[model samples]
Target: MNAIQIKNVTKRYKNVAALHDVSFSFESGKIYGFLGRNGAGKSTLINIIANRIFADSGEILIDDLPAKENIKVHEKIFCMSEADLYDAGLKVKDLFKWINRFYDSFDLDKAFEIAGKFNLDTNKKFKALSKGYQSIFKLTVALSLMVPYVIFDEPVLGLDANHRELFYDLLLKDFQHNERTIIIATHLIEEVANIIEEVVLIDQGKVLLQDHVSTLMEMGYSIYGPAKEVDAYCADKNIIGYDELGNLKIAYVLGEKTPLPKNSNLSASAMNLQKLFVKLTEKGGI
Candidate 1:
């Protein structure tokens, strides 16, 4: 069953249109990469899905029921964003206890385990932790909430490399054991590329593309050789973007299956999510 469905959703702020007729459905037990450039409405869509904000027009359904302020739907979904949601004066331990009491599916033991892994000090006040630790605290809560759907908006924002890898590993382990739907909206596409099964690319508050990663990669190719040779070979194709350095020219092209000429280095290349996002949203058309 679809976990969440958004139909013709639109949001406006004064003279600006934040979202324009956005529609999409999210399935259960899959990791989705919600990608877009800055000001592309990733956070806006996520907030609507979390029911934290109301759309100006259209509707949102969670499990076939209207999701607005529904306690059942709220219990099944958890959203963690960059905005601080905890009480600044509360100690870490107090925050944990409060969350445990509030969330029906909260796992205190798992929360403690995650806190230990991150070396978080429960005695410290919420405002006392470093920026990275603050993010770590929020991540631990999201993981231990054990909700059916977890939406993370740049969860690893202030984390270092080691902690970031650890977060991914822990997230993967939890997914394997709990089988929940995870939606990650972030600019760090390449970091989570391997873990994300499907991708939803948005631009100007509208979805540009949504498909399985493997299928999307099959529609694009990268070729590299002498500048003149590579240019000649890609002459008839839609060259999305390219780069040239000295005698070498690497070009990104989207087309059907075709044979490469001899004397040119040619191979089917995997599409980088970051590059694909830039190419699709750069000119305001996908």
Candidate 2:
């Protein structure tokens, strides 16, 4: 079943259109990558889904019911946005307690378990923790909430390499143990590439592409050869992007079974989510 459904949702800030007729459905028990560059409306879309902001027009449904201003609907969703929601004066343990009260599915034991893994001091106030630890605390709360749907907007912003890997590991493990829809918005596309089952590319307040990760990669092909030869070979194909280095050139083309020049070296390449996202959002529209 679709955990959330958005239909013709539009949000505007005076003259600027933050989101334009955005429509999509997020299914249950799948990990989705909400990808885009800076100012691509990824955060705006997520905020709307979280019901933290109201859309100028259109409807959003959680569990097939309108979600706006619905406390019950909001209870089932957890959003760990870049914006800090914890009180700076509150101790880590106190913050967890507050969250536990707010979220029905919150597991205090799980939160403490994750915190222990990170070596976070429960007695430290939120403001006293380092940036990385702050993020870890937020992640701990979100993960332990075990809500039906979790939306993480750049949750790994200040995490180090070790913690980043740990976060992904915990996310996958939690998903396997408890079925829930997870939508993660992050610039670290390569790190989560293998874990995500689906990809959603949003640009300029619109969704450019949404597809299974494997299927999308299958449609991408790369050609590498002499600069001029690569260009000539990709002339007729729909090239998503390319790079030129001295006499060598590599071009990424999107298609299913396209003829290539015999002189050029062509191979079916797996698309890097980061590279594909950069190419698609570079033009602003897609």
- Number of the top-ranking candidate, with TM-score as the measure: 1
Model 2, range 1-286, lDDT digits (tens) per residue?
Answer: 5579989999999899989999999888899998887887988888888888899999899999899999889888989988886789999999989988877799999999999998899999999999899889988988999689999888888899999999999999999999899999999998999999998888888888999999877867677777877777777888777878888877877776567666556544566566667777675523
Q: What TM-scores do the predictions have?
A: 0.88, 0.85
TM-score result, candidate 1: 0.88
Clashes (N, CA, C under 3 Å) per candidate: 0, 0
Show model 1 residue runs off by greater than 4 Å. 223-238, 242-251, 256-268, 284-286
Cα lDDT listed for each candidate:
0.87, 0.86
What C-alpha lDDT does candidate 1 achieve relative to the native structure? 0.87
Of candidate 2, the 10-residue stretch with the lowest lDDT total is 263-272
- Highest lDDT scorer: 1
Please give, for residues 1-286, the per-residue lDDT of candidate 1 as tens digits: 6578889999988888889999998898899999998888889888888888899999889888889889988889999998897798999989999999998899998898999999999899989999999999999999999789899899998899999999999999999988989999888888998889999988888988999988877777788777888888888988888878998888887777578886567554665656667777887544
